[model samples]
Target: MADEMFRAPVNRSMRTLDRNSFRKVIPLHAARVPENKNISKVRSELERSKDALHQDRLGSVFPDPDRDRAKSGTKCVLLRPGRRKEATETGDNPHDGAEVTSPPLYSSVLDALLEQNIIDLVPYSLYLDYSYWTYHDIISAILPEDELGEVPSGFSQVGHVAHLNLRDEYLKYKHLVGEVLIDKNPGVRTVINKIDDVGEENAFRTFRYEVLAGPDDLNVEISEEGCTFKFDYSKVYWNSRLNTEHRRLVSTFKEGEAICDVMAGIGPFAIPAGRKNIFVWANDLNPDSYTSLQDAIKRNKVTSYVQPFNEDGRSFIQDSAASLLTTTQT
Candidate 1:
């Protein structure tokens, strides 16, 4: 009934109503309705009842149309009365596993309630919950097989920003998908669409991005395994996904080890290594990355072990490695 009324890809539409599905979807108040109540009676009782989610069709209400199911004591979903066209489209039974080619998508029961709500309908956003249903989960049920390419499995995040590289076909729904992500993931402060690649040889490897949702700030503070890094997410590259690798690599180096980071971007590996009392000669071609590395060194209190340099990787290795290596070894 929830899927029929709200339009979701819930169960596969059971040939026979499963007990677990019954318990999950069946509105408790509707099943308890006494006598031969109609939609009017069901609505009235549902209004007073606590589990009154939204509008009801008639699954849980009084005498089920078949009457045979009600006699058999089978709990069912609330559904509407059948008109000729509707009956033919849905078949004799709403439980017949008939599919709607295009159904409305909702993330949660509360979201549906907000749409079909009787009282207190203003803050619909507050009611939306994306835990069980993601934008992909909802859109897949509504779009045709050919359009399934539109939904992405997941996205990348740096700081509070969600970066999505959508296919050309999915461009139309970009804003919609972005909004869904913002609503679903409360931690995300912004959703950015990747408009272009990191083309220029700028130190930060900066790329073009268009803000799809939330505020415009790209600077973010990221908390990884046990490190905090702050940077302009757009101005520099920081992949939160590689945090484990940073820790894993840091673990391999023993105390008093001399480390040379030729392409250290914002001290992810270098600063963490320095925290373990290892000496680090870190260099980045990007001025922004060098500045962030300086800030992170102070923030992590590893200034004594980390030496930050703003120079090309080749120059840092050829001109500086011999002196730093000799000093650290001694």
Candidate 2:
């Protein structure tokens, strides 16, 4: 039987998943080691588990507000799996360092995940998705050996745009960085360097960027978890990496549950939930984000479910949520 999913807002630090922070989650059963080369087979295995908890929780890598403070560039949030049981069982051994056995269901899923390079091999953690690599990995591989230097491991992707914060030494290689990013990542057409810190009015979290390569157009469409979001890269904030989290959050709301999204940027969370027949009271301070969000709600045909507000979140709560709370309680 399935339990109700975790419903609280997860204030996870997006794009700041410390590799050392997560340990591997070994299951109680095991399947034969998957063919690492065939990602499709592994993906199919991952889909077989009917249990939602067995599904990868690594889907939404939320950002940490406190850690990202003073940092102006976009943060790369990675999907990490959630909790698992520690009981030991028997099955096919995984790898040379194998000790414990995983359950039959989890075994195939985990093994397949490891094969696709979709996940990392860490103790007490589930298989990591290897497709999500560190900026260091990308920079190190692309850097020419003749340069003869260590590469800084920091970069963040916001929608189709890759944001980098480079030191003085990297200024010269800015062009190469842009090229490598575009070549390596699909749908990424813009690479920009953050040259300044976000100002006090960080409502949009928008920062000044130096274009390194790719098209000048900052407008883009991002489709995630069945929702299509259209927004301007330069004016509003949108994290495409949070697709899993958006869907995860949406799953928690029972049908027709009313949600109040205070900082609903482009309705990443609001619009999708609305489409599921949930009622939403979404608010955003950024006029552009609010505008795009409305357009998305219309585009997704969720206008009946989402009520957009241009006012600040706090004021919206005071003016609107309070009344709804009383009405619902009565």
Candidate 3:
């Protein structure tokens, strides 16, 4: 059977979306009810019926656009997918030949409506536009038919930036995917694809990336565990996925306890723990991470409890332990 659902227009050559191209007209079944007090009752019954339309971001009930709301008291409650009836001679009303009998799936609903004497099933032409299609739907439609099931729909968000790790096959359509992501996600203004693996070239866990869409501003501020951290996303390492781990680790530290974070990057661990009055000696080897760590400490107003250091993890551990021991002795 042919697919009746709306799909994105297939146009690999097009960089921007052609709104007109995505327009689709599909036939649906709708029940017209009087504008009386029982209108809500009729609608509720239809909505609970199995044959009611249930599409994401689309409402099942719609006003009769041809009639003025103040003048007319009738509304249309759309049913699930159905066949279209032939239009009348004037081609104005498509409600011709709408009988009381319905498909088996909706027979119970039809009987209830008939008993209430407040329903008239009619044919409706649903016009779906560009905004109707979701990111997965559009990406699946645009990619090659063979690669339809393998659409790259997953991405990591860092503030307003969306980071995608496109496979080798998807690199050619990286820009198109990025554009769709930005259009679908209102909060994301920029999209980038990781060109290299994390920590592949450096111990800082930073990787090279290319901008797929939007501006190249990587400076971002994000809040976690009641603390706000600001840093350059491109220069420092930040993974929102580790938020749970950070929270779990910070919860273990008590007030007035000393924490020596040898590999702290941008103060994800240090700043939150410091908020509880814990003394944290956060250290990192990368100068960029160290700079951002210090900035985060100052921004969060935890400078008195959180101290920033620039040193390798191996040496920082020994130095921090010695300093702690000396402080206790003194």
Candidates' C-alpha lDDT = 0.64, 0.61, 0.80
Cα displacement (Å) at residue 125, model 3: 1.8
> For residues 1-330, what per-residue lDDT tens digits would candidate 2 score against the true structure?
111221211213322223343223232222222233443443344445431224223442222222342154222222223336557754465555545744443444565565766544332222332233444444553445544385744567766777778878767767766765676678678988877776433757777788987887788887877888888878887655677788888889987677799889899889888878888888889999889998999999997789888997778878877765654456
The segments of candidate 2 whose C-alpha lies over 4 angstroms from its true place after superposition are 1-155, 198-201, 322-330
lDDT of 3 by residue, 1-330 (tens): 115464555665555555566778877767777655656777787777756677778887776534564257567777777543433234244566443432354658766786777777777778887788898877776777777667898899998999999999888888889988998999999999999999895888899999999999888888889888788899889999999999999999898888799989999999999899988889999999999899889889998888899998888998897785565446
Which of the predicted structures, 1 or 3, would earn the higher lDDT when compared with the native?
3
Q: Candidate 1: where are CA atoms >4 Å away?
A: 1-6, 9-133, 141-145, 199-203
RMSD of each: 13.7, 19.8, 6.6
Best by TM-score: 3
Worst 10 residues of 1 by lDDT: 119-128
Look at candidate 1 and give me any clashing residue pairs: 30-60, 57-79, 57-80, 58-79, 59-77, 59-78, 59-79, 203-286
Off by over 4 Å in 3: 1-3, 9-16, 65-73, 83-108, 111-117, 325-330
Instruction: Arrange candidates by lDDT, descending.
Output: 3, 1, 2
The true-versus-predicted C-alpha distance at residue 304 of model 2, in Å, is: 1.1
Comparing 1 with 2 on TM-score, the higher-scoring candidate is: 1
Model 3 RMSD, rounded to 1 decimal:
6.6
Every model's TM-score = 0.62, 0.52, 0.85
